[model samples]
Target: MSEQNLSSLTNIPSTEVAHENYLLAKLILEIQQTPDEYLPNLLQIVRLFRESVTMKPVSSDAWVKAMDGIKNPHPVKKAVQQIALSELLRKWEEDGDEEEQTETAEILCQNLEENPVSI
Candidate 1:
């Protein structure tokens, strides 16, 4: 939509984003499963979502999706859900051998020390 059209439309204040935690994940899944021929407007939707979040950062699980999009989004919402999934796999890298776990634990300890508890 044009800037004029966006300005003319009813506005949604930053304090009131109408999306759930996993909404982005769901949307990405749909976009990925959906054939490319049906996604002429996907880029517009993604841009809108990016703007909404930028206006007011929400505690959203879709941050992963955002990161994936940044790293490598499909050609105008063709299907970057796989990218998000690939990023998500980094979480499992921690479940590894003894040396890796110990190194990870050390890093976590150092981070905790750097940012001590504030209770």
Candidate 2:
């Protein structure tokens, strides 16, 4: 995978992606069921699917930058960066919830304005 674009590799057309949607979900469940020793490999596969779905290009740019900043480079930054990236991906997934909450808040504001609370 060196020098290969992971995002492009998993970028299936939307039509084809629809067909694989269920398969992808099932694969996620299977990965959970898979034994511990095999998880690292399975996770890499999951990362590919995540990149494809998010349409975000995944790269080691953050890790590379972190390493460059360190006077004594260690592979620990790689692990740290991966964890940071995973948390970021989770945030991206949850971003839709913010929109829903904003809408609900606006509706509440409208209701409150129409029926102002009396002290």
Candidate 3:
């Protein structure tokens, strides 16, 4: 990741997955602004999902399913992405930080209509 990309990532660290996905959509839209990359974005998405399990602490089966979703980038990818994005949105709504709320809504409104999560 270039300095620009790192700066971009640092600029927003969502407490939940929907906001992460929303921010990621924004990142994709302006991808040309950063270095051409691969796993950084994907990795970030997966990382966001993983963090959700930590935040929620569900059953072992659920945890495994979540991990499995990203561990292999196959049929579960879309589902996992949606789950993560859903979490992000939930957190955004519950978040008390005014800065976070505005940021999350702005990102979500900007991308949700187009992205649709495919799942």
Candidate 4:
């Protein structure tokens, strides 16, 4: 008599599958015991769960296609940019020690020298 290969044996149930089965059983029991008025709310939650489980992720191409209609995706007005820079300077001026304040001011001056704002 010859021995069969171990590889030919059927796959055993995984812990994840067993956990899912247990959760489903618990949910079924809860649904049965739930009050009549709350059953509708529970069913809605179940429907939402089902939808979430089946929902597929949007692809990059899909995202590009969806956004193609917009002319300016992120338009930053000149006034808004100026206001942001002023607000940043105001915040730096209000807080920090003298040494730290001087360091920040130097850094800001270096950045402005590197990249001069047109507006």
Candidate 5:
């Protein structure tokens, strides 16, 4: 990725950042649990998922497409994707980190104060 693209990845919306962090962390856990034979593929999937989520106009559609791209002939790959989707849904349904929630609110407030949006 170019430097500009790398910079854009870091500039994801705060709401998306939390989701990305949670997913990445969970992927790390999954990667560790995975057998050596499947580790590389799982890692690649995680990388692709991260890239998809960081794209401009972030949406779940990117994630769904990435998940779908994995070949279905391999049951392990499908299982891993299912697990990731389940974890993502679980995270979204639950109340997230309170500190992160507060930090996001603060950032929003600061942005609003700095650049008031005209009606």
Candidate 6:
């Protein structure tokens, strides 16, 4: 699939974010069956989830629910999530829209405060 299509898939409607979580779970199962084909798409979906979480255009709960579908072990999952969030924040700081930059910074601060990561 084209990068445009992959990006579009990540942009789930806010109202349908719950449905996206279900879809993500199914995708995870599919990836296990066809890793070579599905892995890239799965990573794209995860990037979209990270964008959703950082951008805060959708419910944070929905983003968290979508992340729950990642099949990695607990520590790895946590680390990956943290890394995604950090990278998004860094990217936003560098080049995001001014309004979104402020909003994302606030959300990132709140998340960090609420869920401190252990090294």
Candidates 1 and 4: which is better by lDDT? 4
Provide the overall lDDT of each model, using Cα atoms, as 2-decimal numbers: 0.60, 0.65, 0.69, 0.67, 0.67, 0.70
TM-score per candidate, chains pooled: 0.23, 0.23, 0.30, 0.37, 0.27, 0.31
lDDT of 3 by residue, 1-119 (tens): 56566556645656634686757656665664556586598669768988887796579999899887656557666677768978987886786588978886788788978765443
- Index of the highest-TM-score prediction: 4
lDDT of 6 by residue, 27-69 (tens): 6555656658777887898899988888847588977877765
Global Cα lDDT for candidate 2: 0.65
What tens-digit string does per-residue lDDT give for candidate 5 at 1-119? 45454445556665767876645555455555679998788879879998998979747997677666643336776677768966875674477787776786689689989976332
CA RMSD per model (angstroms)? 19.0, 20.6, 18.1, 16.0, 19.9, 16.0
> In terms of lDDT, which candidate is strongest?
6
| Rank ordering of all candidates by TM-score, starting from the highest | 4, 6, 3, 5, 1, 2
lDDT of 2 by residue, 1-119 (tens): 32133334345564656656645644555555699998888889879988889885546997678666664445677568768966875775677587775786688689879976332
Which 10-residue span in candidate 5 carries the lowest summed lDDT?
A: 1-10
Tell me the deviation in Å of residue 9 in model 3: 34
**Candidate 5, overall lDDT?**
0.67
The pairs that clash in candidate 4 are: none
* Superposed Cα deviation of residue 17, candidate 6 (Å): 33
Against the correct fold, how does model 2 do in TM-score?
Answer: 0.23
Cα distance off (Å), candidate 3, residue 112:
3.1
- Candidates 1 and 3 compared: the better one by lDDT is 3
Q: Give the least accurate 10-residue stretch of model 2, judged by summed lDDT.
A: 1-10
CA lDDT of 94 in candidate 5?
A: 75
